[model samples]
Target: AQSVTQLDSHVSVSEGTPVLLRCNYSSSYSPSLFWYVQHPNKGLQLLLKYTSAATLVKGINGFEAEFKKSETSFHLTKPSAHMSDAAEYFCVVNPGTYKYIFGTGTRLKVLA
Candidate 1:
């Protein structure tokens, strides 16, 4: 079937290091992909997205991702992760360019 898979359910990192949260997806259509960050007790915020126009996309808080059709992946990456980056991140896909179907979830841990 069609779905998004975040390779790691959780990622731990030091406060001032790079962060890598892997996400891979598959769809019959050219999909709409997104990364959303949710802080504790807060709603989801759009971090970045790939809408087929651009392969490399960037979003808030110095995060970016590349849409690779060959690899069937769109992984979230950030240089020098902040202490505030300790939050859950979700990989979302829209098969019809409508609303999103999100992955289960990915929890991020920031260690001082």
Candidate 2:
């Protein structure tokens, strides 16, 4: 199985606050990393990805991550957490397989 790690299983924040979702991974070959956001009863939305290109990858919804091979970490960060951001976040790795291996999954709660 591919290697992936989520530093937190849950994150709580107030609206308009900053958000960070930490992840670290290991792979035998080059890894394709993805950050997906899931709202309640909603499918996963691609937030960002790292494809062995640039170390720093920019993503939709003003999110970004830096791929660090030394530390093997790909952390998700947002300047401000919107109420809509209160959902589940998953850190996934593609190990050249059809099925995606997801992290434990993080639940984000936005406080008013």
Candidate 3:
């Protein structure tokens, strides 16, 4: 079985500051990791993904995550934060079973 854990339930950042969202996972095999974002009342958007090709993967909107196999972690980071970046984020793990395990969620709040 595969599962994802998002360390934080909410993250608050000031506009223009760096952003970090932590995530951890447990899987039976090499897993596929993805980060998705959802704005209020909006559909989820794929931010980035790791499919066993690269340890470090970059995604849309200056977001990136590193696949740390040793730690079983894939933490998301962004160089700077923006007001528009406020949204709910999810960490997903696929263990090649065609079933995805989703993290609880982390809501990003960008403050002025």
Which sections of candidate 3 miss by over 4 Å? Answer: none
Query: lDDT: which is higher, 1 or 3?
Result: 3
- Model 1 lDDT tens row, 1-112: 5799999998999988999999999898889999999999999999998988879999999999999999999999999999999999999999885567899889999999
Minimal lDDT window, size 10, model 3: 93-102
lDDT of 1 at 103: 92
lDDT of 1 at 9: 97
Candidate 2 local lDDT, 2-111, one digit each (tens): 77889999999898988989998888777899999999898999999888899899999888999988998999988998887788999999977786778999999999
By TM-score, the better pick of 1 and 2 is: 1
Task: Order candidates by TM-score, high to low.
Answer: 3, 1, 2
**Model 2 residue 43 CA deviation in Å:** 1.2
How would you encode candidate 3's per-residue C-alpha lDDT over 1-112 as one tens digit per residue? Answer: 6789999999999999999999999998988999999999999999999998979999999999999999999999999999999999999999988798999999999999
User: Backbone collision count in every prediction?
Assistant: 0, 0, 0
lDDT of 3 at 111: 100
User: Model 1: what TM-score?
Assistant: 0.95
- Cα lDDT computed for each candidate against the true fold: 0.92, 0.89, 0.96
